[model samples]
Target: MAICKILFFLLALCIWCGKCDVFYKQVGDEVSMKCGVDSNSNIEWKFNGVLILTIDGKSGNRRKGLSHIVLKASASGDILKVPRLETRDSGNYFCRQSGKQHIVHVVSVFVKPGPVLLQSSDAELHCDITGDPNKEVQWLRPNGQTYNEKNQVIHLKSVTSNEAGQWTCLVKDDLKLSVTLTVVGLQTTAVNASKGDDIELPCSLPQSVFQRVVGGTWKAGHLPKVSFPTLTNTPSKILHWNGKDLSKVNFTTGQLSTNFDVTLKNVQSTDEGTFVCTVEFDGEVRLSVETTLRVVDKHSGKTKQHLGCTLFIRTLSFILYGLKLWIWIAVGASSVFLIGLIIVIGVVIQRNKRMKKRVRKLRSMRQPLTDKDYCQCINSSYNNCYSVIEVLQHLFF
Candidate 1:
C-alpha cells in the first residue's frame, strides 16, 4: 500500500510536470493497462490536468472510467482499458485517489502510423506495440505469408531491380499497419541475330508481377512499332514491316501472362538497333527494358559499305565487256559495208573508162580525113587521129 501511494504520488507529480511513462499503440487498438493499487478505494483519473473520471467510496469504487476509458477493479488495483485509441488519445494519463487516496498508474500514449511508404533500398521499418516487448508481433507480407520476425526494426539489406509493394504488421485486437513500398528503375540486355533470321526481343514478367502490368509498348529502329492493349487480342500498330499491310513484327503474349516476346521475322541489317519495351505498372509506375539488336551477315563478314567497292568493280567490268562486244560487232559490220562500197566504185570507174575508150575509137574510125590527121595517120603519132569527115563535121557544126 505504501508503494502504491508512492507510485501514485510520482504519477501525479509527472502529470503536473508534463512527463509520464509512454505507451505506444497503433490506431483502432484497445489498450488495457495494469494498475498497482487497491480496487475498493476511491480512484481519480485525470488527463492533461483535467478531471476525466472518479471512482469514490460512494460508488463502491467499482465504477468504470469515462465513456472512453474502462476501469474494472478487483480486490487489488485492476486494469484501466482505453479502447479505440486515436491521435487525440495520445497525451498524459493519470490515476490517483479522488479525496483520500486510491491507486494510480500514469501513462503517456503515442500513436504509431498505420500506413507507410518505403523506397527501393537503404530502408528500415519500425513497429511498436503497447504490450510487452517479449511477445512476438505478427507481420503480413505482400505475398500473403505471415511472418513473426520478433524485431522492432527491420532492415531491407540489399535491393535489386527495385522492390515495392504493400507490407503489413498486425498486433492484437485486429489492428493492422500497412506500408506501400515502391522501387522503380531500368535494366538492359544485349542480343545478337543474323540477317534474314527471326529474332525475339525478350520482355517477360514473372508470375508474381505479371498481373500488375496494365499495358506496354515496343519500338525499335528497324522493327515495326507495335503497342499491346491491356484488353483485346489484336495489337495496335503504326507501320507494317517490309512495306506490306501485314506486320512482319509480332508482339506475342503468353497464354497466362507468363511470356511477352516480340518476334521480328526476316531480320535484316536495317533491323539492327535498340529495341525498347515500356510497361505501365499499377497505372503509376513505368518499367522499361532496352535490348540492342546486332544483325550480322556472313557475306564478306562486312557491312554494305565495304561491299560497295566490290559490287561497283564487278558491275563496271560487266558493262565494259558488253560495250567491247558491241563495239566489235559495229566495227565488223562497218568494215564489210565499206569494202563492198569501194569495190562497186572501182568497177563503175573501170566500166566508165572502157565506155570512153570505145567512144574514142569509134570516133576515130568514123572521122573524115583532116589534113593534119591524114599526115599523122601515116606517122606513128597519128594512129588514132580523127578522119577528114569528123574534122569537117566538127568544123561545120
Candidate 2:
C-alpha cells in the first residue's frame, strides 16, 4: 500500500507541472526568471532539455556552459537573467532541482517594424506572438484606451496625428510589449483645372525622412492598405502609378531631390478624386500624402456639378411661382361665385315675403271688389303677381 501511494503522488506532481509559465518580451529587452527553490538547492538549468548550467547545493556555486554569453545565473541559484534578448533567444527554459519535478518557463521574443505614417493614411498594427496562438491579445492606447481584439490586429483607417504614441500589446493580461508609432503632416492642396487641360498634383514627404526613400507609388481614388509593388535589386527611382508602370504617369523629378509631382496630360471628369502619393523606405517603412482634383468643363466654364445644381434650383423656383399664381386665381373665382349666390338668395327671399302678403290680401277681399280696392291695386306695381289677375273674369279663365 505504501508503494502504491508513492506512485500516485508522483503522478499528481507530473500533472501539476504540465503547463509552463509564459513570458512575452520585445526584441532587445531583458528578462529575469525565478526557480521555485531555496538558495542552497541543487538546481540544474536546461534549455529545451539540454543541460546549460548546474549549481552546487553545498557551496551555492554555478557552472554555465559555453553558450552562456548573454545568459546570467544568480549566485544563490534561485534566479536567472537573460539580457539584450533577440529572436534566437526565444525557447523553453527548464529548472530541475534534486528530488523535485521540472519547472518550465516559455519565453517569446518578437520583433515588429515601426510604422512611420502620414496623417489621414490607413494602417494596421499587429501584435505578433511566436508561441501560444490561443492567448488573448489586447491593445492599450496612450490615451488610456483599451481594445480587446481577438485577431491580434488593430486597423486604423484614416490615421491622424492625434493617435500617434506608444501603443502597448497585452497578451493573456500578463505579458506586455509596447510599440511606438510616428506620424507626420501630409500637405493637402486643391487644384481646379478645366477638363482637357493639364493639371499638376503635388505631394511630398517630410524633409527629415525624404532622403531615405527607396521606392514610391502614386495611387488614385481610395488608397490601398499595405499593398506595395514588387521592387527590383536597386531602389526604384520610377514611381508606380495606379498599380502599373510609371510610363502612363507624367511625373517630374527635381534636379536636387526626388519629387512626386504628377501632371495629368488631359484631366477628365473621371480624374476628379483624391490622389495619394506613397513613399517607401527600407524595412517596410512608408509615408504618404494626398491631393484632390476638381474638374470643370472648359466650354461651360463651370463644373458639371455646379451646372446641375443651378438647373435644379431654377426649375424648382419656376414651378413654385406658377403654383402660387394658380392658387390665387382659384381663390378669386370661388369668392365671386359665393357672393353672387348670396345676392340671388336674398332677392328670392324678399320676393317670397311680398307674394305671401299679396295672397293674403286677395283671400280677404270680397267677391265683388269695390272700385276703391281695384283702383288701389292698379296704382301699385304688381311685383308680387305674374300678371294682373284681380278681375273676376281673369280669375275664372
Candidate 3:
C-alpha cells in the first residue's frame, strides 16, 4: 500500500509539469518545445492531445506498455521535431505523460507565389511586391497562365496597332495579400484632311501629352502607305497632293505670314482640291487646323487688252490732230513769206525806172547848150568879119 501511494504522487507531479509549459513558432523554421521534468521521472508524449509515447515497466515486458515506440527524450522530457514542413504542416502539437493533459503548441506556415521576371521584344518589366515579409510576384496572361519569358518587356518589338492592349502583374503573400499591375499600350491619334478646292489637313497631338512620346505613325485615305516624318528644329509645315500622288508639301518659305499657308504655283483648275498639313512633335501628333481653297479665273488678260485698245485709239487721234494743226501753221507762214517777197521786188523795179528817166533827161539837156554856144561863138567870130562883110554887102545890096 505504501509503494502504491508513492507511484500516485509521482504521476500527479508529472501531469502538473507537462501542463505548465507551452510555446509557438513560425513555418519554414525549426520547432522546439519543452515539457520540463526531471530525467529520473517517468513520462509520456502526446501529439494533438493523442497519447503516442510513454515510459513504463513490467520488468523486461516493456514492449507491452508503449515500449515498441522510440521516444528520444531530452534530459527534461522536452519534445523537439522539425515537422517535415508543408503548407498544411501547421497546427497544435502537444506532449503528455500519465493522466496529465498538456495544451498543444501551435505555429502557422504560409506559402505564396515567387518573384516573376517578364521579358518583351524591346524592353524588360520587373515585377515585385512589398509586405511584412516580401511577397511573391507573378506575371499572368489573360487566361490565368504564366507569361512567356520573352514577352516580359514593357516595350514590344515592332509595335503595331493590333499589339495595343492592357497587361497585368499579380503579387501575393502568405497572408493572401494581392496587388495588381496595369500596363497601358501606346496609341496613335487620328489625322484629318480638310475639304475644299485646296484643303490643308492638320495632324497634331495634345501639347501636354505629346512631349512624353518618342514617335508616332501617320496614314491617309485609300493611299499607299507612308510613315510619319520626324520633326526637327522646324516642324513639318504642310502636306499636299499633286494630281498624281501625295507629297510632303511645304510653304514657299520656311515661315508663313498667315496661320499656315501653302502657295500653289500656276494653279490649274485641277489644283482646286483638299490639302492637309500635319504637325508632329516628339513622336506624337499635336495640333491640327483645316483650311479650304477655292480657285477662280482672273480677267487680267482681257482687262489689259481693253486698256491697250483704248490707249491706241487715243494716241492715234492725238497724232492726227497734231498733224492737222502743223499743216495749217505751215500754210499761213508760206502765204506771209510770199506776200513780203512780192512787195520787195515791186519797190526795186520802180526805183530802177526812175533812175533811167533821170539819166535820159540829163543827156537831152546838153544838146541845147551846144546850140547856144555855137551861136555865141559864131556871132563873136563873125562880128569882126561882119563889119567888113556887112559893109561890103550893104554896098552891094
Task: Specify the highest-TM-score model's number.
Answer: 2
lDDT of every model, 2 decimals:
0.53, 0.60, 0.38
Please provide TM-scores, in order, for all candidate models, with all chains considered together.
0.35, 0.43, 0.23
Report the Cα lDDT for candidate 2: 0.60
TM-score of 1: 0.35
lDDT of 2 at 118: 53
Candidate numbers, best lDDT first, in rank order: 2, 1, 3
Tens digit of per-residue lDDT, candidate 2, span 65-103:
655532543433577777676655555566776233332
> In candidate 2, residue 332 scores what lDDT?
85
Instruction: In angstroms, give how far residue 334 of model 1 lies from its true place.
Output: 92
Error (Å) of candidate 3 at residue 396 is 99
lDDT of 3 by residue, 203-234 (tens): 43222221222222233332244322332232
lDDT of 1 by residue, 1-397 (tens): 4543444455466556654554546666555544355766666666545555666644654444453433322223444566666545544456654212222222221212212221222446555432333335566667778655756456564334333567676654544667665543433457666678787777655433312445556666554554322312224322112222235666533342435566777888887888887665442556677888887784645655554555455444453545744566678899999999999999999999987887676667663645654454556655465455465565444
- When summed lDDT is taken over every stretch of 10 residues in candidate 1, the lowest stretch is 109-118
